[model samples]
Every structure is written in structure tokens, then in C-alpha cells.
Target: MDWTVKAGKLSPEKLRSLIFNRLHRRRSDILLRPGLGEDSAVIDFGDEVCVVSTDPITGASCRLGWLAVHVACNDVAANGAEPVGIQAALLLPEGVQDEFIGQLIDDMDAACAQLGIEILGGHTEVTTQVETPLVVITALGRAPRDRYVTSAGAQPGDIIYVTKGVGLEGTAVLASDHRETLLSLGVEEAVLQRAAGFFDRISVVPEALAAAEAGASAMHDITEGGFCGALWEVSAASGWGCEVMVEAVPVLPETKAICAALQLDPLALISSGSLLITAPPQVSIVEAVARVGAKAYPVGRVAAAAEPVLILPSGERRRLTMSVEDELWRFLAGK
Candidate 1:
């Protein structure tokens, strides 16, 4: 019959052939287009370039509008652009109360206001086809054409840095959407509350722009595939290898508690607030990130094109294959 697929993102192979390859037409002004590791599209507009990215909110039940805005804008920021505005499409399941839409818009407004961006425009509707509310946002930003970064620009000897703790968004989703389940599993309400607060840290705009200005070689947002997936994408896109110290990857206490209670791999959990960056060893991205009130953790370095390996906490090496998948969907799917 026809092709069938899983619920999460399309695998890199299928995406390249079916999506990326299908776009045969090209424009000279479009410097950056879609690719395996690319999350945004860049269009040259004379002196400056516009970086636009589209993302949909699906995994989490709560904060749909907020997540939609931040997630889309996060992609633009990963390209080292200054986000200016967004256009959101809200698709809601039928039979929902009016209060629900109000809250969703309010959340979106709050997020946009915090980021100093506006909701330019979009469409919203209630439909029977959806079981839950879905928010899709298209965010746009601008930066000097010569200063923008890409996921495919990493080279050998570049230091790999991940900003903030991994599994941040996953921890928040579990805490907000599955609080009762976690409470029953002995997680304290305080921990859950803190986890929910992680929503505020969802945007990587400040640190990403800082890294770009610091001459970062490559940058990627840790989203669906978590840190593991982001690492694989950067390595694959850059056509290089990486050696990461597993112990050096930071995890919040609340994230650890939640993942442990749920038997989830924090490294493989969906982590949206984290940013993976690569830069020359001499560049001081640490200071640049710190200036933005964020910290950069050096967890690895880019190596020759061989294979990505993780030096486990126990000193044993494990290969990080392209097959790595996000853990959030597995739990949500009850698999």
C-alpha cells in the first residue's frame, strides 16, 4: 500500500529524500534553506538577512501557545538572529470552552512580550480532527548577512558547548502535564513547581546571539531528540565526529528525579531549552554566554570524520548512532 511512519519527527534519511530533495527550485537570495540539521530559513534582504523558522507544539498538553511561540523563535535564534516577531496558527479540538482559547492566547502574549516580539498574525479554528489544541508558529528575525551561523559549519578541533541543563523542556512537560503521576511516585510538589518554571528558560535567544557574535562555528537547538539527537545532527550535518564526556553533560536535580521516577533517559529526553554550539578552541564563548546571563558547558570537541562516541561516566566508550530517538514520545505513547 502506502508509506507509514511514526508519530515523532521523520527520520533524517526519509526527510532528506522526501522533503529536502523535493525542493528543487532555489533562489539566489535564499542563503540558507531546509536541511537535516537546519531549523530555519534565511533570506537575504540587502544589508541584513531575515531568519525565519516554523515549529509546532504537540508533545505537551499544557502551555501550547507559549511553547509554540518560544519553540519557533528558538530556531531563529539558533541561527544567531535577533528575533522580532511571530505569526501563530492555533488549531483547537472542537467542543472546547471559550476560556481555553483565552488562556492559550494569553500565554502566547506573555511569551511574546517577554521576548519583545509581536504576534504579527495567523489563523485559529476549532476542528473535530484534533483531539487536543495544536499551535504552530512562524518566527522571524534578522542579523547581518556575514555574521549568521549554521548547523553545517562545524570543523575539526572546534569545542562543543551545550548551554543550560539538558532535558529542561521534557522535565517541565512531565511536571506540568503529569504532576499527579509524579506526585504518586514520591516526587515533591516543590520539585514539580520548579520544573514547570523551566518554561521561562525555553528561549535561547540571548546565548545563541552571543555565541554567534563570538564566532561560533555551528549551533543547534536541542529539541525533540534531546541532547543525544542534537549531537548526532550537528555531527552528521558538519560531516565530522565528536567525542563527548557523558559526565560533563549537566542535568538539573528536578530533571534527574523525574526521569528516575519515570525510568526515562534524561539524555534522550526532549530538551528544548538547551543549545548545542561548536567553536574554535581559542574563542571565548564562555565569557560571551556569561555576559548574557547564561552559562556554556564544554562537554566535547569536534573530531575527524569517523564516528561520534560518548565517553561514559564509567570510562567505557559508546557510539552515538544516528538511530538515537527522543524518549518523550515513547512515554507519551505508553510504549
Candidate 2:
């Protein structure tokens, strides 16, 4: 069966077993002792707690440094911690120029400076094995030991909220990489520019900070697997189920147009900057998101259901699923 299809997908139990079976041994010294499955990995440090996460930019070779810092820091912030430092590793193909490295570093430095994060260290080199440049960033952040949030903290009655519209990163990447195609199709240059502006939306620092301040109990950035993927992770990690309203999930006009043209499900596309947060029903998460210059909406609620289900606007209910076949795979395979 096609894993992407809503029907005939693997059951959540099978998927969870498949994930845990591959693990070697679990660590015992974890400081912020939350149950399995949380946003950032928490390690207890004296007087404070550290949240660490790492991510990679796979599709775009340009803006490698900028993408690296933002993507990694976004995860750190989602834990309601202030990002403090970053360490990067750059893998570049052979024959790459020194100027390219210099520019990438400059971009990285500028982005870090904007976020008040220091670039502690990194490794950079050129190699023939790599066909293109790839950057991986590991970011570290800290918060008061008493204030950290984890995916497991989400209660069944809490409301599920998302910051920013869906497909921010996907639309930005598509607009930048397919500028000529968009122009040929008679899309306005202004609209394309706005869509390409999603590159700036590649960070969740503001939304994370706002949500954290508003007393969110759990946070997960929507990245490779989009909103559906995020929902699955949060639910599975918390050992709870959720019911998401498909129409209530926010999707931008540009993203809808691009997805329609590409014949892709916007919910399945990659969105690096978007965040999925769970908070008490009393917290005004939507208002908090607006203060940070991002949009937020209540897409669903945590529930006591046995499994994750998505309620379509048409009144049909279907299971939500994820796959190794993400937007990146689909794009490359189609090309």
C-alpha cells in the first residue's frame, strides 16, 4: 500500500514498535525526566536545564548557513528556552570555492547575531563524495529547570494550536527554486516575492518565545512531515490521541496555489518554521502568536481517542499518517 494514502496506512502501534525496536539502549542520566517522545532533548545541568536539538537543510544549497542556524534554533526555542549557541558542520562537494564558504559563514554569523546566539564552533571542508553542500547545525539552549515543557506534558483536554500558516518553508523553497516556472505561468512578480519571503519565516524563535510565555505545555516545530506529521509525533509521544479539523488548519493562498499546481498535499509538504504547540484551553495562544507577527489558529484538540484521527470538513474521518516519502522525496522523484 502507498504509505502516503490516508487508507491502508500502517497502524500507530506498528510504527511505534518499528521505531523503538531500532534503538540500542536508553540513557538513564536524563535531567528533565519526561516520558518518551518530547520536542527537545532535555539534559539536566546544575541550576538550569539544557534543551538540545539538531536539524539539516536538505533541499536548497543556497542559504545553507542561514537555514542551518534558524532551523536548529527553532527547535531549541520550541522548548521554551532561549537559544544560546550553535555548532555547525558543513559538507561541501569538491571544487567548491573559498568565496562560497566565506559567504556562507557570513550569512550564518549574521543570522546568529540577529538571534543573539553565538557560533561556538564548526567543521568545514570540501570532499568529492558529496555532490552538493549540506549543513547540519546543533543548537543548545537553556531555561529554568522548573519551567521547561515537553511533549509528554500535553494533557488530553488541552487545545492544540499552530503558529503561522501551513507550508511557509515549502512555499518559499518552491518560489525560489521555481521562479522561472512561476513567471512562465503568469504569477505576478509581487506575489512570487511574497512567497519567496518564506525563507525569512524559516525560524520559530518569536512564536516559540510567545507560546512559552503563554504557558504552553508542549511544543514541536512542524518541519519535514508538515502539520499532519507533527500531530502524529505529539500524540504518539504523549501516548494520547488527537482530532484535528482539516479546514481549521491554516494554509496560505500562495501555498494553496503552489500545492494545487504541483499536485501535492499542502499538509504533507515541508514547513520548517511552523510550530505545533499544546496548551491549556484558557491560554490565548492565537493572540500571543499575533503579537510576534505570526498567525495562529486552533486546529484541533488533544483527546482520549485510541488513535489519531483527522476530521475533514466534509464530515469524513480518516487516520493521519506519515512516510519516508516526504515532499523532498516526491519532488526529487518527480524531477
For residues 1-335, could you state the per-residue lDDT of candidate 1 as single tens digits?
Answer: 44687678888888888788899998899999888788889999988999999999889978888888888988999998999999988888888989998999999999999899999999988898899888889999999989999999999999999999999999999999999999999999999999999988999989999999999999999999899999988888888999999999989899999999999999999888899999999999999999999999999999996777899989999998776667889898883
| 1-335: candidate 2 lDDT, tens digit per residue | 44564322234455456664566666764754333345467888867888988777777765778888998998889888899999998999988888998999999998898899899998887888788888989999998887777777778889998877877887888888887777776677887788888888788998888888889988888877688777877887788898999999989888887777677788877788888999989998989888989887898899987667899989899997534235644775667
Task: Show model 2 residue runs off by greater than 4 Å.
Answer: 1-28, 32-39, 322-324
The best candidate by TM-score is 1
Prediction 1 global C-alpha lDDT:
0.91
Candidate 1, number of clashes:
0
Model 2, position 143: C-alpha lDDT score: 84
Give the backbone clash total of model 2.
Answer: 0
Candidate lDDT (C-alpha), each: 0.91, 0.80
What residue pairs are clashing in model 2? Answer: none
Q: How accurate is candidate 2 locally (lDDT)?
A: 0.80
TM-score of each: 0.97, 0.89
Cα displacement (Å) at residue 226, model 1: 0.1
